[model samples]
Target: MMSFISRTVAACLCLVLLGCVAGQPERLAIDPRYDSVAPALQVYMERVRTGGERNAVLNWEEAGLAALELGDTDTARSAFDEALLRIESVFSDTEAAAKARSVWYAESIKDFKGEPYERAMAFFYRGLVDMWDGDYENARAMFKSGLQQDAFAEEQQNRSDFALHMFMIGWCCQMLGDYTAADEAYGQLREFRPDFATPSRDDNALVILETGGAPQKYAAGLEMSELRFRRGATQGVSRVDVRGLPAYPMEDIYWQASTRGGREVDRIVRGKAEFKVVQESVGKVMTQAGTAVMASGMRKDARKETKYVGAALTLIGISQMVMAANVDARVDARFWRNLPNRIHVVTTHVPCAATLPVVFRDGSGSVVQGGATTVRLLPAGNGFLGRATFLSSLLYGQ
Candidate 1:
């Protein structure tokens, strides 16, 4: 009977090792035929095509950003829409979430919905796409949604402090001639970020400067159950000056990432870690005790009942050890890698047939070489909007 129980436990352990062990997902590979395409775009395009549903949100985000940068609004719109659809879906229904709650699965098993900041940026890009399409109402909605997503910051005081989205919402309202709504949005923006200048009705063009790189995420703590963020570097540009308006720092992506506090799943992972520790300690003690009992039972003076008891305890201890070893408490560290470190904004009118002058300055306010010098306004709805991204180190020499 003892031998039969031992075989059953061993078979179960084998099944777990063979079928339930978590494996890393396959990395996206670029085909050699697309060598002529820009490397970033090529990689993002490949990710969108091959990453499947588990990585769908992240893949689409990279693809959308790349396409948007290349002036492919149609593709960017579609990618952002797909990503938003998945992100806004019920969290409980996700495969990663379902599996992650179990002791045997890692949190990375879930689909990539991204951190709050990444999710908010999705709406920011989609809003821009809508703005370009003259859908001011939808654009306003997207900005508002982004604000809602940003409101989930871990610290209560930090929640809903994303002044960039607030400003965009106001800009969208102003474009639609809803001055009252615009006033409300601008009022909120002033409440949170007093330094930002409120745009006047005559201010028609908005310039957005996306500078620097994204925050980095990694797993730490016991069983790798804690999620942490490292601040991303901002290259050469520290201050920006546009010819006709105040270009001030509106959002810090790293601050948003770091302030997002803890997730509910974090507690769940920690609990699993504690359970594993307890099980391991108990199993070790029981195995040691069982071994001592079995050794005594092997003596000629020991009774048959003692031998049976020792075998049962040994089997139980082995089963507990197997279960403890199967526990997985790793945190999901998946993130949007292509996001900007900081976003600066300026709102003012641009004349027809005129270009807006932009100056990217380093820490000492000296103009950065090779940085964006001018931006041509794009006609949107009844007005013009100018947008440009200036990378400090990536695109210019300091």
Candidate 2:
């Protein structure tokens, strides 16, 4: 038999050879659907090499994830907050990052908002959170914001269906007063949805579709409605439609089908996409909207203001903006809907001259613009909330 020391030595050697230990990153093409953590971690690590608040952002995010995994809500919140601040620096230029980060920042808004999706997903019960947490209104509002990005697309329809996921979507819509659509969503489901996590992808394919505004339904349709250190005011919005198959519920794990039937089944090609809806909200005589840009040495920083601009809304709300159809999909593609540790900040002073570093698209769909006009790289609209708020504060002195 091998001696204790010999066994110990062998284990260590094995770990090193397998790239299991030694604090080294395991180079693997991660499947985001399985665990979104890897992508988040990789980005954090690369940014940390340069160091600063960016460093703090990564550390806090990791710690928060740990705390969350362990059920330590307090620690998780603190870490999340820290992460938010770190990534909050850019809101304008970094488009891709803000895409995903926006979900994080939305958690708190109108003083009553929470990152609709993130806050809901902080636990295994995202659907419940979306429905019960006094959030459905904001959820609807959040969806509205997503449309502003013009990221949704036609190919997104007929996404894989998960009974529970559709239930969650329908339920949120129900709470938000979209009973008709809610019912319609429910009608499409094959069974009643449960409220929890599961172990496998199995037969469930979940998907979400995003619409801007209140989506005025013909008898039926209608619609409605972020960021910063200043806190309270809602600005910039993005919608992400998570339509597709939701995984099998943990309770249903035993219900899976056996492959013994010899039935040939084609794997469904389900996907995620986003769109920028509406046009850029502009301001006018009686309204205040769009960013208020100012020159250097000016007492106040420039601010983007909006009234209620939708491409269709121009006849009414001048400042309301919407992303047009053409470039919307491309922009949504920038924010792959999955990045990590989104912190949002506003700029106290607009840079004299800002230039983004050379951007090579990462799978995340955002361009890493270094010099200026960027976001938490655009995970959320608030990715640049910090900068926007900072400039707003500097200029308006509010």
Candidate 3:
């Protein structure tokens, strides 16, 4: 009996040591050439290189967007491809994932796949990279895949509600000269998003506008295990106008980010938290009771049976206390930061060669200071594509 108790205590101590030493992440050095890139983008690139596979998805997301803004299609394509590949892969069966499930490990120790919306946005950017290359068929497929990702939301009602992908799917179909498929895609958009004006077959220019800042992520609950998002404020840029073109509000990213019902991590984290509390509470009770029994046994009148029971109970209590100390219940707050808050689209008929003026207005219809630009439509065979990105943090001094 004494041998068994000694073995159990030794095993618990070993586990505690193994849990503390295992899964220490490796850090890599960043190349100096990336130093010349934009500061925000440089940081993401460094994280992508430094954090390695564990945080590949999160860092690549920021890096991809930043690369796109700099017109570095090669880097953007690489970033999105790396992120999407990991996002689509099955990580649950891997060793790291298995370890992460243990109470001794943090969920963040597993390779991050990101929230559904973040995964969807990776597809969105990958699709845009295809569009930039004039590969309409692949671009259409990418948009459809993005919609599929959005369909995986925990709440069924919120699933498949990303209107931007549907609209872009229609545009890609139209570009490919598949009028029937184009109409079908547009029809679906019309069903859910009636506010968006349907594009005419004759229209040859598509303007995509990305505005505002990324949603902020934070952990909630007693153990900081519940994932939550704080929607980014628009900061005075509410409405956008393109001369001689019709513009529409396509999608709000914050809506997609927050609407996903719940994560499986939520339950696991909550369970770990509760388990820790129970272990600690029960351990204290057992220890106190055992101490009392042992004290009584020390008295002249106590029997040998009481002394044995006290020793066993005290050992069990100590083991439980040790287990409780090793429990890790903190949430993974890593996110795809720097994503735009909202996405908007503008369309116009062909022969629109002139550089068209774009205006940004606040909620009260007042023009935002310095919030205007002239965008020249780039020729896309029979049509054209234009892009405009706004970072309100940089624009409005946020």
Candidate 4:
């Protein structure tokens, strides 16, 4: 029996070595064209960690490339993270592969709008896994975000992997009691592949299949991976400079509760309510209208921006009337997590051109505990620039 167990263990090890590890999905393989390139890359990687200067940039590309082949996302994310970290250094370094390295690097990251291509694939697969596991809501968000990141990926082959991905979203949404959203996703899918027509009205099978399970419908993830791999090879990735700004570096932030709100949080959003100064000093009586909202921003480059989101609209007693000022006097702005705080937009209907009292807030309605507030001039749309954290928080929140 012991000898038999030994033989079984050896057999398992052999299979793993042959890339057939039990319970692990068969991963995409490196192309034959890369056969020569792979070994040379392996050698180069070792040199960097020992005596040679760390080619962090090239290593990023190489590591990402390898991790992607093995379908290892966390590793890929770390590799890209390192590459982005070395951007400034990369600019100063000299390497024969820099041009090619830059291409993969740029294709790997994006701002709040989305993520890079390979990461998008990771998200796509994660969504696929979620779908397989019957977690539709989580799957929907993942697949949606994956498309946002992997838009036009050379790997996606312009074949509307997007359409197929959304089909999964619709499937999951249908399972999650969100049939309306599922139908909408199905509708948008037609826009991607005009050739895809809904089953004939008399064909009841399609409806039955979507509404009822045929034991967790088939997933096209492998096909997706293959199509994407083909696209990546064919796509020409030109390096896109980090446009606008990157997300705030939360890792660098050292948070120790301080009484001073000036405590440089990771980000801030300052919005203006369209309320004009009803009564200012003796000389300034002006009209203003405020918009209520919540917004988020990144602290990298210490950024700020505005959006014209109409106040939180509602139907009250079947009549339309603006909601009263947040009695708590707070809104959440600055930080991509929430609707922006109400920016106190006190347009100087005041001919005096005098500054209006602008208040800012943190998330809570309380005035930003304590701090020195500096505000830029409020541009068109937003009236007064509220420098206080408390007032800014209230604008978007309550």
Residue pairs in collision within model 1:
96-110
Candidate 2, residue 367: how far the Cα is off, in Å: 44
Q: Write one digit per residue (lDDT tens) for candidate 3, span 273-378.
A: 8888899888888888888888888888889789778877888888898898889887777777677888889888758555778877788877788777766677
In order of lDDT, best first, we have 1, 3, 4, 2
How many clashes in each structure?
A: 1, 112, 0, 59
Tens-digit lDDT track for model 1 on 1-398?
99999999999999987775565456555345334445546667676657767888988887778777766677778879989998898766656667878898888877888888899999999999898888999999999999899877778898878888999999999999999999999999998788777887998887788778778899998878889999776778787888845488888889888998888778899998888888888888888788888888999999977877788888788889989998988888887877788889887766663577888789887877766588767777777776667752222210
How does candidate 4 fare on TM-score?
Answer: 0.25
Report the candidate with higher TM-score, 1 versus 2.
1
Worst 10 residues of 1 by lDDT: 389-398
- lDDT per residue (tens digit) for residues 274-381 in model 2: 212333323242123121222221334423232223222334334332222222221110010121211111111222223221111223534223211222211111
TM-score of 2: 0.24
Tell me the whole-model lDDT of each prediction, alpha carbons only: 0.81, 0.28, 0.80, 0.32
The residue-by-residue lDDT of candidate 4 on 1-398, one tens digit each, is 99999999999989877773344322323334333334424442342233122333433444443443333445445544454444323243344233212321211111111113333434544553344344567768876865564353334344234454565566556556667887787687767545544322221111100000001111122111111111111011111111111111111000101111321111110111122111121112111121222132233442344212211211221122222221111121112111111111111122221323322233343333332233222221111111112222112111
lDDT score, candidate 4, position 344: 17
Misplaced by over 4 Å in model 3 are 1-24, 27-40, 244-246, 291-315, 350-354, 392-398
Range of the 10 consecutive residues with the lowest summed lDDT in candidate 2 = 263-272
Instruction: Quote the positional error of residue 195 for candidate 2 in Å.
Output: 16
What's each prediction's TM-score?
A: 0.84, 0.24, 0.84, 0.25
Candidate 3: global Cα-lDDT? 0.80
Candidate 1 root-mean-square deviation in Å: 4.8
